[model samples]
Target: MTEKEKMLAGLPYQAWDDELVILRENAKLLCHQFNHLAPNETAKRHTILSNLLNIKGQFHIEANFFCDYGENIYVGDNFYSNHNLVILDVCQVSFGNNVMLGPNVMIATASHPLDPVARRATEFGKPISIGNDVWIGGNVSVLAGVSIGDNSVIGAGSVVTKDITGNGVYAGNPCKFIKSI
Candidate 1:
């Protein structure tokens, strides 16, 4: 299988593969243009995002949004992201309806192997799924292979390392369960 196929399958892949490098460069260029678009060019922004990602319904992402492999990211209806949103979508990153993300929210699917030798050779990724009606606050770093269930809220500055089930507020570095709504 090709390196991109391995990446899509959530397996270890050579990050420096020529095709993947070209894809990343293309995404970066598109993101750069989207980020630099005039504030009045709302329709163009929407068009760019629609072309860049697998999206549905009405959505808005503020300036300075960045992603790797825009094709691997999908956002559902009524999605909104604040400024400085960065998604490292080495694997699929899917978001359900009505998801909102605050500024500087980093959603990453890429990770390195624990073995030093392997880490330098190949990189792996896991999918991240965010269910409906989830609100993620600012400066939240979501690691690979995490699923945030429906009606969940992640507090600002939280580092999410594990799966978060629905109907609760999660906070802190390790992301603990707070009150349930």
Candidate 2:
């Protein structure tokens, strides 16, 4: 399989492969263009995002947004993200409808091997799935392979390292359930 195929399949792959590098470069260029546009240039921004991401419906993301591979990021309807959002979507990063992300939220699907020798030679990633109507507060970091269920609220400054069931408020590092909502 190709490096991109291996990456998408959650298998170890060389991240420095030529095809992967070109894809990342293209994404970065598009992100740069999107981020540098005038605040009032809504139409232009929309056009750029449409070309970059797999947005299912209406969505709005503030400036300073960055991603590893735009094609690997899929956002559902009514998605909104505040400024400085970074998504390292080496694998699929899927967001359900009506998902809102506060400022400085980083969702990473990329990971390195634990073994030092293998880590330097290859990288791996797992997909992240966020259910519908989820609200992630500011400065939250959702790690690789996490699935957050629908109607969940993640409090500010949390680091989520595990799957979160729906209809609850979760907070703190290694985010724990606070109370059912």
Candidate 3:
């Protein structure tokens, strides 16, 4: 299968070493479009300057956002991000309706293998899914293969390394459930 096909399938693949070069080139073109628009263009340009990857009914964004591929990331209606939202969407990053993200929040779906030697040669990405009405606080980092369940809240500056099943508050460096709501 083609490399893009493998990526779409969520299968492991090598980054082809030149991925960043291609991304840089594409980013320049996309940025130019973003910069030159008159504030109503759709279908490639961002919905709002402050808000990057918004679907209909999604709201504000305060800081910069970097996405590997914008089309692979989909946000549901009424989504809101505060600031510094970065998504390394090597795979699909889907958000349900009414999701809120605070400052410095990162949602990553890319990860290297555990072994250092293997890490250099391979890249793996699992889809990151966020259910409806979830709230992620400032400075939080979400790792690969995670799903934040519906109605859950992630505390400030927490690093989420695993799945959270919903209806609770999660915190800490590795992000553990603190209480259920």
Among the numbered candidates, top lDDT falls to: 2
Best candidate per TM-score, number?
2
lDDT of each: 0.96, 0.97, 0.76
Name model 3 segments beyond 4 Å from true.
17-24, 27-54
For residues 121-148, what per-residue lDDT tens digits would candidate 2 score against the true structure?
9999999999999999999999999999
Error of 3 at 69 (Å): 0.9
| Candidate 3 global lDDT | 0.76
Q: Give the total clashing residue pairs for model 2.
A: 0
Q: By lDDT, is 1 or 3 better?
A: 1
Runs with alpha carbons beyond 4 Å of true place in candidate 1: none
How well does candidate 2 match the true structure in TM-score terms?
Answer: 0.99
lDDT of 3 by residue, 67-153 (tens): 666656788888888756788877889999999999889988888788998888877788899999999999999988899999999
Model 2, stretches more than 4 Å misplaced? none
* TM-score (all chains, Cα) for each model: 0.98, 0.99, 0.82
- Candidate 1 achieves a global lDDT of 0.96
